[model samples]
Target chain A: MRLAKVQKESYDEKEVLLHLKEIEENIDFKVIHKIYYPYFHFEFNVLTKGLMKKKITSGCVIDGVNGRGALIDCEPGFNQTPIEADQTIMEELTYGNAGEEAKQFMYRSASIKLKSMSVPVLALKKKTFFYRPFYVVDDGDKRSNHLLTIDSITGNFHPI
Target chain B: MKLDGVIFLVYLLVLLGIGLWFSRNASKSSEHYLLGNRSIGPAVTAMTMQSSSMSGYMFMGGPALAFQQGWYALWYALGDAGGAIINLSVLGKRMRRMSEALSALSPIEYLEKRYESPAVRVIGSVISIIFILAYVFAQFIASGKALTALTGWPYEAALLVGVGVIITYTVAGGYLAVVYTDFIQGIIMVLGVTGIAIMAFSHISLGEVNAQLASIDPTYLSIWGKDLAYYGQWGVVIGAILIYSVGYMGLPHIVVRHMSMKSTKTVKGAIMWAATWNQLFIFIPYLLGLAGIVLLPNLADPEMIIPELAYQFFPGIFAAILLSAIMAAIMSTSDSLLMQAGTILSRDIYQRFIDKRATERRMVWISRICVFAGGVIGCIVAIYQPPSVFTLVIFSFGVLGNSFLVPYVASVYSTKANNMGAIFAMIGGATTNILWTTLELENPTGLHPFLAGLIISFIGMWIGNYFGRTPSPQIQEAVQNAKTRKKLSNPLEKKISQDMASESKVISDFVRKKMYINEGDV
Candidate 1:
């Protein structure tokens, strides 16, 4: 399957390794593998009608694996080039389901920000499937083997 | 009905009404019924967690233990007071995120999804069903006792009525009813207990009560307990403290509260609510028991200390309200336990194994049947009155804590913990607790059964992990995501924005191009 991916603009393998070393020293770490995590990116043109009409542009991301929706302040650019996706990482949530979740998230956020009784009507401007890169790293220490993941874009690390 | 009985009946009616009111919404979907669509706010979440954790044990078993062991019983109280804080702070956010990410509706289902194994769910269902039923049975007995005291009904009659009402409301309203009722119960519990404390103090001050207790048996005043029964037993002391303090994490009923919270933001406000409520409520039961030693000298059953004291000090109406509070403690915990067991039986067992394609409506019916069946069995068993409330509660609670604590903590904190580890931990911990208690290991080895079980469970997890396969990439990723903090540091946020700048620019340009094309068409 072809998957659109976000280009890594900040952290590379060397920088991620350095970041891990800075967090925890004395461990011989190596990248075991990388996975493309799936997300649905959505943009909406929201219009609210009341005493005063309001229109705003909003965007949100729905996690394809979990169906969790989050309102994002800014949109991310896709690489435009599509890459081959491994069959194992296919998302369980379909585009329609993700879009519905994104719409709900956008509506809730708009209503809260506007602080109004009027319901907001959300028009879908764009919806696209995208993937983010995450590197899985493991320390070779036999005694206390440690596994972690580093975001290839943001350089954030968390224990696996 | 007498005035007291009338008041009690009114309270029961209100509970039933509330339960029936939510019945329509609860039946809409399995998620709605099982987890209230995860919309519970901070106050309700904290109170429900506490009220469910407190159980009838707080009103009856706790006071009874305090009456028997003297000041040393405060150790248990101390643990109870801190249990929610530790439970919420450690497991609250992570469990909420992980359970949702896994799309698990039941705690047992959460374990199975986290470990990626069907057998995990099977074993978890079995253990939880057995002990959770056992736990609820203790509540049934407490309910009978409380009702018998309030209305002068026969124990058998009281048991049936109490258990019947609990099952009715629980089956009707589902989790939302249970939680909202628990919030009200939590308030009633604190007020009733505080009222009794004030009246007890007015009759005889704390100093005088202590002095009288010492005069009767100096050991009653000692931290070592009456006759120094547990003196120098650091193992026992620590176990008493650990049982409630961290044990809340292991309970399926309590941990479900974390999953049902509105969001991760609920944790902070919940912790504060739980801590404040616990301090106000937990210590008083044990203290009331201590005062019972001086006041109700000829009391027949130690478990009756609280009820007996309330009637002795307060007026008839106030005492009846206090009885309602006692009943609240029992019903709140009982309903939660029943709801969880039903969820496990229906979601983890019936649907997962028995009927894979069961419809949502069918599953809800199955859940209700399971809960009703459990209540019937519990009521029948409670009629026999096998053991003291304190003993039964401690036994069931200890086994449960031993069984699930290790696996639960490992699920969020350790990525490599696999199915084998969890299976071993559950079997090892539960077995050790049963054996230690049955064999009277505490007397000979000075190790509390709970402590013994915990040690074996941890060791079992380590051993089993060494032999088990590591989790798959998907599971590991979920763990990582669950551990990620919702709020990023200022510098980290700025860095993330900078990292995505190129992507942002590309999206902006694409949008602009699309707008220009639309304008040209116009």
Candidate 2:
């Protein structure tokens, strides 16, 4: 699975920088990494007695540039290639582990199965990776400065 | 009390679980939170739309009206049965296409983009917020009354608990949780009401019911209520019918459902499902109320008839489910209204003006806070118990329809509709509705307040358009593009083989043009 091309972009570098400045003060931040954020999605078929088989979908979004992550519950488009790690300014891209997140989902489903008399079998069905364009910002001098990501399409700022 | 507390607690926990589950990702982006990323399926979409539209009135107010007026209540049901289909057929596919092309996140945002005016955005947003709150306020009051009746809890306690649960799920999970809960609630509503109606029918036949009604009064079976000779009954009948039949077009909460559908091709299946559901269930509440005339002849409060009958006819657990069905009716509508109110404040009000460059996370938090605040206000209003839930619901619905119907309909269908027309129509319609209701004017031509407001709204649009400036070329082009998009004639076909590659390419080109998938990208 790979990142998808941004469907739309209405903001430029200056607009992103201006939005970043509004939230933080007296600090100069530069785009440390211009990369797409990766959102990992997985669909599974869980079979149980009496209740039949039900499909459970789960996913998580990783900032790709800053390593910040959150569980995702949306269908993301996937029609483009992922960014190569070598092409970016950062030494290595920080991507959330999709397999770990999938296990968490399985455990949650298993906890519910414990209440019922039926044994549940969980099987992986499909996996997709979606990416939205983001500009990872950091203050130029410090090794551990605060990281902020700006959504390129809607020009919304997110602290990562 | 006849209701089981454990069953109700389980329902609340499941709803809270759903909210917590979806809350993890809801903060990722405003689009994901507000519209579920436009990936909802036809079944969920249809169920959500129907559930959101049918509110506390379906349980309490509707049955009360039937108890008071007999079959005259059926006129309202007649309008409601086909209202969703008419609403979707006229606006669903086209609005979905147009909203996507315009990149409008909310209904007000859509109107702003389509009409090309900031003034339209401000006015539309204000009107929507006010009327939608009124709608939510009605639901809150009904919830308090229903909870108090079913569980013997204090009105204030019931109000707080009910509104608290609704606000929790809505604020945490946003639109995704709202739709999922609505789907479950929709099933509960249909099953509960149908089960009760079937039980009532078994106890007493329709013929016997009619015979009992006739003995009470011949007018009970008439299309007109008490006295048929009080002016022309047809005007009042038409007014009631029109309010429900076409009135759905103006509702912001309902209209947003059209914009959030998975694809334009999903419209047909969604409409069919919605219409079938409406046909199966719309008249059940009214029928149950009419049946009360025979079954619970000595019932004290007409509004409490459904719950009272549920307990008397069914076992405790089954009765509790029916009681939950009433709760579902109130909660479904309240959550959606609360969602729209919060979206209006955060997206349209705060994001648009107060903080133009806020982060998506900040915006999501602000929206949750707005939903909480709105719920509090609804609680305050519900505590006061404004105008018997049914009347308030109808009043809110009528005023909303009057205010936005002409402008919304014109935006989608009329090439000649201008910004001026929309502005005047909204103001005029709202004004007429308010004035008619406040002044308590005599039925000048036997026109109901709703019908009068609708008539004035159209007149306002026509008058404004005649005097208003011409629309810009860009606006005209956008409308034209929306209208000319190809229909999804063959959405189910999978692959075209090597021999049919050319045909496949042609079909693909048509779909791509109409679909707008990953637009402006390779």
Q: What does candidate 1's lDDT look like per residue over B412-490, in tens digits?
A: 9899999999999999999999999988999789889999999999999999999787999989987997787444333
The two-chain DockQ for each candidate, comma-separated, is: 0.03, 0.02
In model 2, the clashing pairs are: none
**Minimal lDDT window, size 10, model 1 chain B:** B256-265
lDDT of 2 by residue, B1-522 (tens): 434666776666776566445534544542354344245566555654554466688888888888888888888888887665677666765675566556454577778787777778888778777877887887888888777776788889988988886776455333223445556666776677778889899999888999999998878888877455324646577778777876655556322211111111224556567658766577888999999988888988788878877887888787876677568657766766666665676668887878987654565566567667778888877776457777777777788788888887888677788888888998999888888877865266576778889889999999988866677776776677667653311321111012112212222333344336446554
Superposed model 1: Cα runs more than 4 Å off: A1-160, B14-49, B87-106, B172-182, B253-274, B412-416, B473-522
- Residue pairs with clashing backbones, model 1: A77-B503
lDDT per residue as tens, model 1, A8-122:
4355677668776664566667886565667788877766554334455656677676665655534565575455543124577999999877865554443333222234677
Candidate 2: TM-score of chain A is: 0.48
Most accurate candidate by DockQ:
1
Q: What is the lDDT of residue A68 in candidate 1?
A: 59
Docking class of 1: incorrect
Indicate the residue-level lDDT of B168 in model 2. 67
